[model samples]
Target: MSKVFDFSGVDDFCSGGFMHTNPKDSNLFFPLGRHVDVYFPRKRSHVSAPFVFSGEVKPQPSIEVLPDECLFEVFRRLSGGQERSVCASVSKRWLMLLSSIHRDEIFPAKGNLDPEEHDNTSISVKEDEAFKPKEKVEFVDSERVKSVNEEFEGIDSDGFLSRCLEGKKATDVRLASIAVGTGSRGGLGKLSIRGSSSTRGLTNLGLRAIGRGCPSLRYLSLWNLSSIGDEGLLEIASGARLLEKLDLCHCPAITDIGLIAMAMNCPNLMSVTIESCTNIGNESLKALGRYCPNLKCITVKNCALIGDQGIVSLFSSAGHVLSKAKFQALDISDVSLAVIGHYGSAMTDLELLDLQNVNDRGFWVMGKGQGLQKLKVLSITACGGVSDSGLEALGGGCPNLKLFGLRKNLLVSDTGIVKLARAAVSLESLQLEECHRITQCGVFHILANCGGKFKALALANCLGIRDINFLFPLTSICHSIRSLIIHNCPGFGDVGLAVLGRMCPKLTQVELSGLQGITDTGLLPLIRSLEAGLNKLNLSGSVNLTDNSVVAITKMHGETLELMNLDGCKYLTDITLSEIAQNCSVLTELDVSKCGITDSGIATLSGAEQLNLQIFSLAGCSFVSDMSLPYLGVLGKTLVGLNIRHCNGISSSSIDLLLEQLWRCDVLY
Candidate 1:
């Protein structure tokens, strides 16, 4: 009775499968008859018909999750260097999936793979399976992604192992790693490192890592590295055999030993930029010339140790292969110039700045040489002794020159410019700044001959140019001038600007700052002529710009104008801001400092939902206050730098609130 096993208590005794139910008990048991004739159940039983074999029953369809391969395919789309590292640490599955991805697909062979390539998975498989175990990846605390000098205590114990494992997540770590990984996977075609100098010296350990990581690195740039020495350079040279370009900037620790070793080891090096390295001299140049046969570009700047001997060695060794040479602040004389002229047959671009010892004789040597025939760009600055005759010689020698820049050459006059214009007829850019002796007649002659081909012409602080009537012929002579800068030219007035505005419709940049004589009359016509073509307009200190001028410019060039400087124009008010807010939706930089704009104007500009303003300077605008501060909070997302200095009406509390909201913007009070 307690067990309730009797057939009398069975509800379905006649059926093949019977359910037992005790009258005293609430529970009921059913016998599900099958292969072995065994059955059991409880409570409410729904036993029906004669039981057949219970072993074979169709299962109901159930929901299935995505497979690992499909999940990995989803993750493949997120595989960037930093993205992959961050995702790999999410789980073991993601780590395996990222590791399985082909190295070539991740790093790429040519240029970086397009973002869209990560989405597709049907790429051709590799011919051979030579798999190497992927290095274990860990998430770099984005907060800890700073210089090694910044209290990263345990990083050095592993001897740059953590840095290599962290990969590109840590910027300072990767800066040291760039030397290692550049050519490691196959060939890192380009490597650039601009050091902060705060990290402890990237010692031999880091250097060895670089050598092992980047074997095929073609281009290497190390800047402001305070501690890297000869050993580091040797390691780089040993690993990056195909290095074609090397830029060493402010690396005072590097000496002739390092430079020579690099030149000797990296045979493919074609370009060398060494700046502010005091220890590298003539011997380094000789090594480079003797070892690097393919040398094409040599830029030696702020290097006081390089003398005439070094110049001669560099020219004698690599001059045949050299196509571009830039020497700045060096003490080489006419002898060095002669050496360059004699040996640099393939030279196309030459820049010499502050060459105190170079004079007309040096230019004469270059003018007479057949080696400079292919020279296209010639820039010389502060070479006081170079005169008209030297310029004439230069003009005649390098007839293929397309761009010429001469600045602060006290001896240069109208004669030199006229001679240069006649010889370099294909010149596109002519920059003659602070050349006081260049008269209107000289400019006229230069423009008459080369104006048609001129793409850019800058003449700033030229006191002798009183009349620009010569510009009247610009419509017929030059229609291609894209950049015209005549800043601080007291004689250049409305008439000059009017002529230029009518002639150059494609002007992308027009800097007429400090031309106080220019009023709305000169400004309106120029902005109207340019329409939407102008990208930068500098009318600061013009003092004559008003709401009318702002309205006209914004209406015509709202879409294209990215930078507008109305600083020192005290007459501007809320109307200017309103017009700009309504029309110039894409304006990124607006400098209305020292203007008469008030709180309402600032509010209007900051509230313009469409304006993507990044830099807003309201310096000396006394009327901007707390009322305007709220509108700036709305711009907090896009703003990068804001100057609220001299805005006496704004309260400190409001400024603090604004600062808290715009935490990213550099707020200057």
Candidate 2:
């Protein structure tokens, strides 16, 4: 018989040992210093300590953990990168739990589903299903997706629309009714139907279904829907009362009646984007002013029918509610410009694109208006009529303007640019593209005025940027310029670039494409000086560059280089690739298309074990073949896109294997 000893004291209890009365048996827990354990009567044996951690037998709570589903709900909220890098590294149990989660669960498959099932797949219909309209075309809305179906090619709008509008003329009406009947139970708030080869034009009937099904819809984006006329838009207005934001892009069928319908039905509509609708006129603007009392933002682009009168009507009616407006590719003249200046007083953001007629007089009128004071972002692109007088007016009128874009405006000269520069000294970003008339004098004036605060400056296709002296003042102006794009500027060579190299030590992106005069003499110093800060470098079409330039780049900017484009650099050889492989480890995108690199060069780079290279382009390399495929397969896990176009040496079978191995990668043949 086993002896039973009963004792209770503070010393025994506090000394990592205790005694408990077991209901099944009179088991006792004793601290023997070395092998403390509980005695079980049924088994007639001693049980080990409940918890043995780090050589200490500590009393532990039972492993009655929460459910896996409960834990998953907490961990799934992490961002994609966080879930993969941080959460998965904790333990095998955690790794398994995360791995068990279906990718579709993490990032739901969006877009229109196929008629056969409700599963989230990009493939909606087979070849036979393209002709059937009686079958319902299922559209499901998901949260922000990273990408859409690119393989849905070869399917045009005619075939897709045939399926959508098939079987019956009243199908759209039925779908709308169904949507409306579902109400808030469907939890539909945002719907984005972007263009796809298989996706057809959506008319009023389709919209009816959306309105009926998604009655609580707050945002709707119908892109490239050419069949959508005012009749369809009216259906949306009537059914979707809660709609606050609507984006109708490239929908030519919509007219002024549709805008009026929206104004009357959606009183809460705060933002509307109507692009490429040539039929919209002043009546729609007047209706919006009268009906949409709370309207705050509007973007009207490529609408030739709506001119100054339509804008005037809109401002006259909804001036108090207006804050942001963009007018692009319009048929507006000086008359419209004056009207905008007079009534657009409440606007904070304004963009004028491709305006053919409005000149300095319009700007002068705006200078005297109330809107100029509140304007913060003013983008004028391809406005040929606006010259020195207009720029001068803007300088004096818009005091708080932080962003100024003057692109494709040949009329803007040195005097105008200087005048504009002096006026907006607080400018943060100045983008001057294809402004051929602006010279070194204008550049100096800009640097002297706004250089202190300027963070981004792009000079593209500017024929007058030849003087090397223009580059000297950049360092004194601001030591840090985040982004600088200099393309098609034939005048500035090695001497000018040396000045830029010293001044732009903080350049993150530098595009020196099409600089015909630049050679190793100019590029090497600049690359070496800005090595640490440069993340993106574009030397495409710089034919004069040799292999030594690549060596300079790898030596200085290996760690920081994420995107490197050496397209059309005929002199770069296998030696360049060898050097890059040995030094650079984090290159995400490397474009060596049309370069004279062969299999030897590519094999070395792909063989590197540390590379996380995602995008690789060897489009015009004729020698790349099956031998290079194995090496590229090393980066299969990280690669997202691979362009092997015109690589005649590669067999179709090898390409198929690559596609199979790298299933997620977008391979271009």
Candidate 3:
């Protein structure tokens, strides 16, 4: 023994877990067993712990004399950044050795560093995957998870697999695995992280590895991730220079620093969606405006710090190139709207929702700004400022506008509707919902003034609309209309339906759900008036309707009918199902939930000659029993989905039997 070097107790140095050394254990110092302090950066705040090396050492030896393998283990044992930094600064060789140690070996990943072990679809989030941390999970997409490896030579553009990690799967080990495994392939292109564990999951370490390895990443989405902050995003901005689209939601830890850096670094960025990010404000938006000239789509919602300054700066620089923009629940007032209207020459779609600060004057100014020449679709909801004058001005401002939708705006009435309709010559469709002031006259004016080009109309929850204004009958009243949806209109009765049936003869796709005012008297005439059979029909929650309406619709539109929903029509019986089975041969979907249909109705439809139905739902049909199981099983050849959820009469054994019979069907019992 030349220097009495004791390397036998080397494993004791790894007392601390994967990402951090045990602050209370002094074994990390190894031969130099002296009391020390350690810090964990992932905690966000500076958190330190004192290590008490109370035990006496058998033989004290210099750490500089340790072998390469011993040094490798020691370096690998140190989890957090501070410890690694402290070690690396000691010498150049230590720094190189520390850099050489891979994250997967240190963190102990679930997947091995090989092609077979890597799950191209997903990755883990915890440091010690073997430790098995509990995490709350959101939807994990398994789309194209099974790789179809059409191998060519070295790294094709589509060679690397797009990964989606959520819950426990979003671990640093998995990120390390993806970094190491997919780098040889074309590198990770797209990644999504949705919802993490109750405790913190992903940190800067994972993103750092991703930065070094998957530099070619293009699209990224992060949702409900509280642990990730500026450092993690900074790493992404530094490496993924070619990134085009980024969507961040409910990530409170990420502030303007991260967003500004990303905007500055990735000049080719095209689309960005920022929702409920409290820390993000004008600085980040200003950076995007100054740096990202190629920005096309921008949606900023529920960010308290964002104001008119941010919106003005963004639209002033990049609005001409933008195709779509949505601003919701922001602090911005009329100034932002005016700036957007002034610069959004190329924008085709725009939405303004829940904006409390902007008033009627602001809306008027935006309309008269005369810059949104190419705007096609516009939706305004829950805004205080959208009045009749503003609507009138907007009609003249956006001449090319094809579709206009208004929701929860109480100030708009018949005057605004008629004025907008007359001025907006290119308008083809109009949708109004929860707009209490919109009377029948407003709807009538839209149809009359839209110059017979109006093809679609949807009216829902408008208590004031006592049907259309038949008193002032215009010649061109929805003559070209094909799709119509009127629901929850308490004032609408048979007279209204009769009027619509006569006016809109070309109606094909119709949904009149939640309308207790109308029965077969109004509906049957509409079916008879159609030039061609209806393709889709939904009469859900129309409890007043019976077999009369169902039988008439099935017989009239039998050939063209593809989908039907008669849910909550408790009066419907086996007769309705018999008509659907016998008449609607090409029907692909049918829902009769909460109906009075018994097993006989289901049995009759199950044995149809060419029912050809793919999706069938009998949920809440208490009359349906186990007797319909075998008959439903016969539909396995063509049926892809079956729902018998609330049928208390059917036993679990019968459901199991039906499951055994139907191999391809997705049965929900």
Candidate 4:
């Protein structure tokens, strides 16, 4: 048993003897002193104590009886430094706690502390005295927090409420506001308050809080935040002087004012993403150029307000430092291209430039500059203004260009293609999709020049391509070509595909979608030749491929195969699918949508461990019923993406089991 003391009404509990509490039990407490008196729980009268020790007996004192130094240590651990200072008014114990907690706050130096003030310190000094002295301590400024917090209304109450509950007991301590103001003295390095959408108009408050608390912040991401504006941004700029990466994507409210403030304040700014900020125009871009001389990468997609002048300003300001620029889906017409060509000549270090939707005149202007020698990937899709002449200029200037996208450029013909093939000797991937005038003659030129290094070739909907003979020379030279896509080429038949398989022995992926003339006869030779590296084969809309082609492919490349797409092949039945499920050991993704697969095919796939399947797409396949759901559950553990959309036969029970079995499944309709 332990003695109990009551001092709840006692205002100050600073000086006292050593307190004691049972080592095993924290609840029983008593004080250690000759004048100590105990009060019974039922009565108010104090009783005298002899304080005699007995067997299996101990004394535990209340918090009021503990020594001031021990009490200060307890309070220091609880309140830290900032809260301890504010709570000091409650009692002497709190004052001691505040002093003890912040004793080592200042940086240590020799001959800094006053000798007269040294005796006033309650903390015992070490005898060795080798420790360096420090100067007087200073409190964190409140004015900086106030200036930044004013822009964010209604956010201060929650912050104050949280602080009030922390230190001492003061019911009347009605905090007016809590601001994390300016100065980079003791600030946070990185401030993140993501996924807090319910706190309306509080994002600015959050930003201000960070600026006040973390002055040395380097990286900040305000993604999907709509409440932040110019005032909050300016506060951050003035406070976080060492900021580097700033991501403000989806922040529609940010305009020229906020962007300019950021550019001017953050000198070490390296990467910035301003996607979907429609209000950002020329003036702000110029500010970015003038302030952030070390800017490297910038993404400003869908910024409709940005025109030729803004782009020119941006390039003129940061062209020398920019290494990557993405301006996708913008209305950058001929004027913008001219501006880029003139001012962008300074961007000699540029590697990737996505100028999608900039017309033919823009391409000509871009080609006129000699700075694009280091350019690698260039995409200029849907630029109706571009003609064959623009491509000729690009080929002549950008000799090191590798991946070139000329999709939807209607004027590109055999002559322009031949010119590009001869000049761009380093070309590895070329996209000529919807270039209706491009013929085999142009492709032959590419084969003769840069075909040996080509990796990916896309010629989708090229109407002039009649035979695969032009590809043979290229495939023969570049045996390393991996991905070959020739969709909607009506002139290509079995002969072309056979030649492709024989020449491109290292091809890993082949997309022959919408080739109506291609039958199993064309696929058989290719499948046999691609027994080594072929992993993905897209034969969608090739209606003529029946059980024979699938059987031959499964028997040949079953072990190494991963994904096989046979969508719209109506003739494929359960017999071929069962054979595939039994033989293909490495098959993970099998897309047989709109095929004539029945319950038998599902049953065949149910027990095969060699399938090791993850993504199973059976959209538009009406033959499968609820019977296949059981088998799906057995194989559901490894499934990641399952698309059974438009499968009318599946019921709610089957879906429930699917949801239970495949914990990581993403079911798409």
What TM-score fits each model?
0.65, 0.68, 0.77, 0.66
lDDT of 3 at 264: 90
Residues 1-669, model 2: lDDT tens digits: 112223233233222223354422322233333323333333323445343322434575532255678656655554432223233334334433443443234443246432323321233445224332232222222212111111122323222211122222223333332232222122246655555323443356566556543446677776666666787677678767878888877767778888789889999899988887667777887888888877899888887788888888888777766889898888888877776666776777888888887877887777656556677788888888888888878877887777888888878898888788777766777888889898755665565566466777778888888755544443364454677788888876787677677766777888889887899999888887773456888999898899999998887878778899998888889888988887787789998888888888888887777778899888888767788887777766788998889888889999999889889999998
Question: Alpha carbon lDDT of residue 439, candidate 4?
Answer: 76
C-alpha RMSD values across all candidates: 14.6, 20.7, 12.7, 12.6
Using TM-score as the measure, the top candidate is 3
Instruction: Write model 4 residue lDDT over 174-278, tens digit each, in one string.
Output: 111222211111223444333323335354644554454445577676655566677768777876778888777666677899889999989899888777776
Error of 3 at 459 (Å): 1.5
lDDT of 3 by residue, 276-356 (tens): 999999988888888999999999999999999999989888887999999999998889888988988889999999999
Task: List candidate 2 stretches off by more than 4 Å.
Answer: 1-214, 220-235, 248-258, 275-279, 342-346, 467-475
* Candidate 4 lDDT for residue 480: 56
Q: Which ten contiguous residues of candidate 1 have the minimum total lDDT?
A: 123-132
Ranking by lDDT: 3, 1, 2, 4
Candidate 3's displacement at residue 230, Å, is 2.1
Best by lDDT: 3
Candidate 1 lDDT tens digits, 443-482: 6566556645778888888877665665445444456677
